[model samples]
Target: MENKMNRRGFFAAMGKFMGLAAVAPAVLGGVFSNQANAQEKRRSAGPGASAVAGSMVDVNDPIAKAVKYVEDFQKSPASKGNKCATCGFYAKKEMHGATEVGTCTIFAGKLVNANGFCASWNKKA
Candidate 1:
């Protein structure tokens, strides 16, 4: 009787292991495909586009001060034609007339004001 119980236990463990092995490939494949899709989106968005979400830059940051970044574009003298949305380094997507917040290449993935400008501003052609 004991021998029979041990055999049943062994078979149950084996079944579970087989099930996991079979599902692993599918799970891994999904992850890889999702990553590939994200990469393609970034590439299509142009040079400064990155797949990772970025943090908003602090106004007190040294770089911000050096670049003369202003949170509100209306407050800056150079805001006329150098807003982030119009800059060469801005990476964002606009949907349904709504502009998404974007990251700037100058800040190396840090989020910037869409209507903001910096010393590195290059007008988007």
Candidate 2:
């Protein structure tokens, strides 16, 4: 009878611990998520920049379609050493302060694909 009582107490303690373990990740994720967002904001800076962060340039946009914009650099005819990142119109310094993606003077406030290509691409001078 005493052993039965001890086993019940142990099971209760373990149940409480398991519940806490499950809730800890959610609580911590919420706490750290804000910090991560703040860091992202710092990285995304440009005109209409709020909407550009983590967004890919739409290939169907008029200019993109007209220019035959290809999202993947490798698939583009300009694949060899050509990409928005190295293009003259790419505003690498003005948007996001990162080269992984940026705005294009041609796109005007819209995010351009980093590994993308277009007919307007010119060698960065």
Candidate 3:
């Protein structure tokens, strides 16, 4: 048999493509709209609101890796007596559930645990 897309097969493929194209905008819009609303709420809630519900920065996060961020200060021997809780780069600390989290100047829009340490750590005044 010849390896070819006959008229019927071509039409079927086109239909599938067209259907996905038609639905993509609505689906993508809803996803993006939810993110935008959440961001707006975070902004309105105050500068410190991020630690309340913001997503935690993963060790694998690009900036986190660049700064050698560690969730536990003890794991970072070079950090010596430094942690997000005492780092100048650390932003407001807040409780999310029972976990202690805060923001870092190096990782905006994300939260880091109080016990976390990073190369950017500076002694807080």
Candidate 4:
């Protein structure tokens, strides 16, 4: 009877441990998903999205002359030269309402039209 009791106790402990182990991943996944959702919500609710959307400039605007310069340069003998991807002002991913535009760090509130170029263009170090 003592031996049977010991075996039952061992099995009970293992069952409890296995149950907790199975639940651990689900619990962690829930926590991470919640955190990601919160961050996304915060970003969409903030000024960054609104600011970019409202301040977007036309690709043909004179203010976007630099954008044109980059395009022209790309076709010239300097085709191998600088590009938005290599520039400091280039925003790799689209944000806010500037889907085709790259956010220029130097332009502050303004996002550079992806097709736009500027004198501030620099090669990525």
Clashes of each: 0, 0, 0, 3
Worst 10 residues of 1 by lDDT: 92-101
Where in model 3 is the C-alpha error above 4 Å? 1-53
- Per-residue lDDT of model 4, residues 49-91, tens digit only: 3344336555466756654444434554444565665676566
Model 2 C-alpha lDDT per residue in residues 12-109, reported as the tens digit of each score? 99999999999999999998998999777666564434454345568987878988888777887656758888888876534345446677777765
Q: TM-score of every model?
A: 0.57, 0.51, 0.58, 0.39
Q: Rank by lDDT, descending? A: 3, 1, 2, 4
Q: Which of 1 and 4 is ahead in TM-score?
A: 1
In candidate 4, list every pair of residues with a backbone clash: 66-117, 67-116, 67-117
Question: lDDT: which is higher, 1 or 2?
Answer: 1
Best by lDDT: 3
Q: Alpha carbon lDDT of residue 96, candidate 3?
A: 76
How well does candidate 3 score on lDDT at residue 19?
A: 100
Q: Which 10 consecutive positions of candidate 2 have the poorest summed lDDT?
A: 46-55
Candidate models: Cα lDDT each: 0.77, 0.75, 0.83, 0.62
